[model samples]
Target: MHPSTLLQLALMGLFVASIPLTMVWLSADANKYRKLVWVMAFLTFDLIVFGGFTRLTDSGLGCPDWPGCYGAANPFIAHEQIAAAEALMPTGPVTKVKAWIEMIHRYLAMGIGVLIMALMFQSVRQWRKTHQQAFAPALPVALFLFVCVQGAFGAWTVTLKLQPVIVTIHLLLGMGLLAMLVWLGGREDYLLHPPAPSRDLAGLRALRTLALLAAIVVVLQIALGGWVSTNYATLACDEFPLCDGKFIPEMDFEHGFTLWRELGKTAAGHYLQFSALVAIHWVHRNFAMIVALVLGLAAWRAARQPALRKTAKLIAAVLLAQLFTGIATVFFDFPLAIAVLHNAGAALLVLLVTMLNYKVKHLLDVSQRTPANADLPANSYR
Candidate 1:
């Protein structure tokens, strides 16, 4: 009966529908595996960025309720209640505009969930007929489960009142989902047939490890970055290479690392001190240097690979974009566009590294003996 409640149900309905709609679109080429994977990959990236937009804009709690705006289908229907909340606390996070942003983020997430499910289903169907062990649907199934868990984190992210640890974990999980999807998509693209061992599998192995480490560094940086954003600590250090005009500003590690507290609280229920905010920002900034060095090395190695040259160059370009965005956030006072893109760049880096890893290592141990995958198969129809 409440407007906010209605809003939640409507959004859930839209989320459910996006799955079937994506399936319908893919029906045109039920066999275009690589193309479908790329399409879904792009959509997942969009979801990540839009999600960043939702959080950075302080709309994560736009409705202050799960699934909708005061039980209504749209903000318009809940305008009276939202306006009342805003009037009570002007400049708070519960305005109608924010509620819409958060709800839209949810809708987009659900859509991506549907697309992955479809990819998994199709992989199963194709694998059955072709006996292609590569696209056997295991990873997709795993990702389907992972997305369910990610949804739970999304709920907790709000229901837990945006606890820093919970929010940071939620951001990591979302990026994790993106990495999984990108890996699957890349595997689907590369493993039409089992790949022959590279002339130097050892080099590939080293690169794989390097890529994984590169991704790990980026994720940690991203988590720190998320902490900074979620707790409104971006401006804790306004200068480029220093905080409060000093390289090592005063910092409170105890409060900053107090994992179980809400957005701006200490473990003992006290308001968070400014030093803690400085610590969060400082750690993230420092990690950026390490990430840059590792990514630079990984990109250089990838560039040397004949097949991976383009992807390697992409890695370099994205790093440049990411670096520019990060600095811009500080010098430019964290403009919404740059902040959102900075987050998006991290997601992109994750996707690229995951895809690169998959291409190099997703070899299937297939003895299927199918004429399709033989020495000179009838066609590369897979």
Candidate 2:
């Protein structure tokens, strides 16, 4: 929290971000802008996965501070404080290992923030030089602002003692950042390789609707999944197909759905009951079925379109993987690796859905233009 500590953290973040920026500069690819966007997207995805790892390992409070470990820039410098905390509670959240995990997650997040800043800087410079709308600075600016907000939530996740709502929103914001980057990258790709004009307006409209619906379903499922994780409800049911070995198990939905409560407590500050945990897990479990059915239908419909077949395949594959990991978490009592992969799978699904949406929107844009340019050849739009 000190000024010097903040400066040190910022420098560390810049140093980590420089590695990828250096790679982007050295690459032979002509479209460095697109490459940088994609690289950021890739790193953002990794950050989300590492974040899951951090949460699953119970390292969120490893430092008991934000943006630094125990008011120190690095865990090494904060060793005395961390050791004292561990001495007080050896098996608690402030162990040396957990501090390192928490710091690493923060470092990655800061690195991403640096990259986004660089992106905004580059976008502005390019737009000024070229005066081209294609080189617009809007998205990079928006991303910079969004990452700032995400960073705030990240701090709150630690400072608020892992309040379920704050933590869930943190997770959702991270995925939302990834989704935005993927859309930006997809937009760059479309600019580089415009698709041929399409006459299938009706088909495009249908796929667009399905893709949008699928994206909505995925976001809701992710929110539910986040709630489950934040509330530590993964092992509440401890069985498959039926919760507590019954079709209608007793649950406390009123307490379970209390959005603003602290972790492990009801709205009225009472210790959360097992029934509430069961309710959280049960809703997430049942919703998975609905998400699967809806996304499966969307993927099938998408696969029927020749242009979107590959994206559709990816959606199907990720959906199946998600289902496996979801069930495996229950069957295996929520192993760390499997649980993290479940989070990664959710991020992947968001990426795929965003891609599908972009592709369908691209097609729809072409379709709308096709009628006006009907005198030209189909390939002329490209």
Candidate 3:
């Protein structure tokens, strides 16, 4: 929290971000902005997955501080404090490894912030130079703002002692940021390779609606899953197909769904019951079926379309992998590797669904254009 510590953190972020910024500068891609967006999207995906690893490993409070480890720039500098904490409670949260894990996640997040700043700067500059709608700073600026909000949540996650609601919201915001980036990247993709006109207007409209709906469903399911994870309810049911060998076990929905409370505590500050954890886990487990159905239907519909066949195949593949990992995580007692992949699968689903939505929208736009407006530049529609 000291000024020097803050400066050191900032410098570290710049150092980490420079690698990707240099890649974008040196690349011969005709559109560096597009390349940067794609790269940013990729890193954001990694951050979200690593975030899951952090949470899963109980490393969220490893540092037990914000933006720095033990009020220092890195774990090395805070070694003494971390060691003392670990010695005091060997199996507790502030071990040296957890501190490193937490700091690494923070560093990666800070690096991402630097990249967004660069993106926003370039976007604003390009918009001023060309006055093109594609270069409009709105989305990039919004991304910048969203990342800021996400960072605030990150801070709260630690300072608030990993409150269930705060932690769950943190996870949701990270996913939301990835979705936004994917949508932005999809827009760039269309500009890079404009889709051809589609004769099937009704079909395109239906697919677009389905894709949008699928995205909404995925987001909600992710919220449920986040709640399950944050509440440490992954093993509450401990079995697949049926939870604890019952179709509907006893549950405490009122405490389980309470919005504002400390970790493992209900609104009344009493210890959360096992029934509440079962309720949280049970809801997420069952809701996976709904997510699978909707996304599967969307993928099925898209697979039949020549234009969306590739994206559709991706959605199907990731959806299957997501289901496998979700089940495997439970059957295998939430193995770290499988669990992280499950989280990664969710982020990938978001990316693919957003891409499908954009593709369908592009085709619909092409189909809707008439002779009078068909001549307008594609950027105009954007």
Candidate 4:
């Protein structure tokens, strides 16, 4: 990397780090490690949003490669190569805007990696002092490993030509990272305010089951959305509430749902047909309806529980936002803004679900509940 490029990378890294650092310093709980975790969690959410922007703006392939764009640390150094690629394919995915978007996403991701490293360091210090491993340093260690895997999939997302399955996994992994960080943050928050007793012992168990159901369905929806994007099928059906103006418009499920092949390719390896794209879009559209109903019902049930109302309402609100953004994407021809919001909404949903699951799980463990709220137990956040 050139001196200037390296300087840019360093400056960007510092700028990204500063956001959370300020939050940590200014928090009411300053000097508390939990504050640091909350800052990381907030920034993780921002990273998820920026990631959506990168994908929506067609920047996933902006660098034309991974880790470093065009074998350089920053786009400034790789400008010439990016220009050449764009010139060869004018409307292709490697323009200057896309490059910036991609690089910015990478920078944010790197910042997160650094923060998680800091978290691990803090956890190790705490664990050594306490000499107990209940809330072991291994939690941070696991997160570190997970993000590295996510970075690998991020690379493959570009290098492998955005293969649907890989891209889909990449999307899910990003969400997984956010959810994990949220859980870590939730642990800290829960530590401050003990865990509430399960509203109904059986209902509490059912909550876990409902959350799991929500997760599986959301994953399926996201995967379907990825398939739609990878195949360039956003406009496959212009009219929503119905596909191409019918209960079921023409489709090529065999081609659309064919799992193991390059992106934009049919099962047998030919260029994908429009109907196949329609099939992909259509399935995601319809499946979303079922997912929304299930999740809405789950959140409503959660709301009925005195301990879970606030989060349940939050989950419900985000789900509605997701539905709106999703419908807007189709009615509005998949504008970049709506598309990004849709992705962000999906990430938010995943995080909320994970927190709900984690919280309820702790409630089930009676010993860990907090003392301030004696009725509830403190989950071990050591």
Give the per-residue Cα lDDT of candidate 1 at 59. 87
The better candidate by TM-score, 1 or 4, is: 4
Which pairs of residues have clashing backbones in candidate 4?
A: 368-378, 368-379, 369-377, 369-378, 370-377, 370-378
Candidate 1, residue 251: the lDDT equals 96
lDDT (Cα, tens digit) per residue for candidate 3, span 1-382: 7999999999999998999999999999978889999999999999999999999999999999998998999999999999999999999999999999999999999999999999999999999999986788999999999999999999999999999889989999998899889889988888777866655666678888899999999999999999999999999998888887899999999999998998989899999999999999999989999999999999998887777889999999999999999999999998999999999999999889988988888778876875544454432322
lDDT of each: 0.79, 0.91, 0.91, 0.80
TM-score for each predicted model, relative to the true structure: 0.87, 0.97, 0.96, 0.88
Q: Global CA lDDT of candidate 3, please?
A: 0.91
| 18-137 per-residue lDDT for model 1 (tens digits) | 665656576866546766667777777888889889888888889776655676666887899999999998899898788889878877776677667777898889788887866677
lDDT of 2: 0.91
Number of the predicted model whose TM-score against the real structure is largest: 2
Worst 10 residues of 4 by lDDT: 373-382
lDDT at position 9, candidate 2: 94
- In model 2, residue pairs whose N, Cα or C atoms come closer than 3 Å (at least 3 residues apart or on different chains), thus clashing, are none
Residue 161 lDDT in model 2?
A: 98
Query: Measured by TM-score, how close is model 4 to the native structure?
Result: 0.88
